[model samples]
Target: MPRLMILFTILLTVGAYLLSKALYLRYRHPLLNIVLLGAALVIATLLALNIPYQAYLPGRRIMTSLLGPATVGLAVPLYRQRSLVRRHAPAIVAGVGLGSLASMLVAGLIALMAGLPREVVLSVLPKSVTIPFAVEIARIHGGSPGLASAFVVATGTLGSVFGATLLTWAGIRHPVARGLALGTGAHGQGTAMAFMEGEREGSMAGLAMTLAGITTATLAPLMVRLLLRS
Candidate 1:
């Protein structure tokens, strides 16, 4: 039974991925992001069938574990852009740090004002960061890691869907500015969109996303501690 369940899960995941990819290519809308589409389908199917998240988690984990290797693979782009990065080191660091801090501060303040529980606020405070680091921050701050994952996904989706349009509306035309904004605000999803623009933009966006994740991960716990104390 376990083997059959595993096989079924694998088949469903692959089918979903293929179908989502085709849809994305045809429609090419940010709001219908492939990741979001695939996740919605999986979650809806599981819910309809009354499958507990734990029951399906092992199969999902097998697929998710590959993300680490995939992230490490982004180092190739960084290496390729070493010279440009060196030239813009200070600007990159400052931009990413400021953007990450601003995102967390806004989320925390809104959550607090909305009377969300401290743990829920903490979970959302790091939502703009990358998934793995955000999960760690959530655990440290007494937030639910699963909820943090969902929050991160939500943040990324919103950022990817609206970020470019917002920037254009604000008259921001520089590739560096666009990449930095998307990478810092949306993390990987935004970076993916930035990459689609061009290699230079993609490299900068990747760098920004990594730095933003690190900054947010480092700051979230401290901010939560201070907020709780006060």
Candidate 2:
């Protein structure tokens, strides 16, 4: 019965994504973001079915395992732009470093100021990165891993939906700048959107996303310790 339940969960998740993709293609609207729509559909279905999240954990874990391979796949785009990427290596590092650090600091400070617990600050601190890593950071900080994952998904979805428009409004017409902004702020979903803009944008975004995640993972704990006075 548990295996059957897991199968059902997987099917529901995939079906929701497919439907959401179709809707996105037909409407071509940002709000039709498949991530947001698919998540909502999955959550709603779980609710309607009275299925506990834990009941779907097996299928979810199976899905989560793919994140590593998917992340590795990002290297393909980067490799394609090696010469161009090397030319701007320093700038790329600077942009990603600043953007990623700024996001963590602002979010962490705000969470602290709001009188939220130290653990809560930790969780939000890693929200700018991918979820699997975010969960680990949240655990180290005594945060709710679930909330950390939720925040990651929300950040990615929001970034993907608004990143391009926001960059254009900010007068950042350069593909590199836009890609850095999206990947640093949004992670994988943002990278996917960057790919839509151009191969160069996608490549840069992939690099930014990889760098930001590693930077966040390495620096977050030290910053947390210092911020919390421990």
Cα-based RMSD of the predictions, in order? 2.3, 2.6
Candidates in order, TM-scores: namely 0.87, 0.84
| lDDT at 40, model 2 | 89
- Model 2: lDDT of residue 44: 97
Model 2 stretches astray by more than 4 angstroms: 160-162, 192-198
Per-residue accuracy of model 2 over 191-221 as CA lDDT, tens digit each: 8899899987887888888788878888887
Estimate, for each residue in 29-61, the C-alpha lDDT of model 1 and write its tens digit. Answer: 776667668777877887888877777867877
Q: List the global CA lDDT of all models.
A: 0.82, 0.84
Deviation (Å) of 54 in candidate 1: 2.7
Alpha-carbon error at 23 in model 1, in Å?
Answer: 1.5
Which is the leading candidate under TM-score?
1
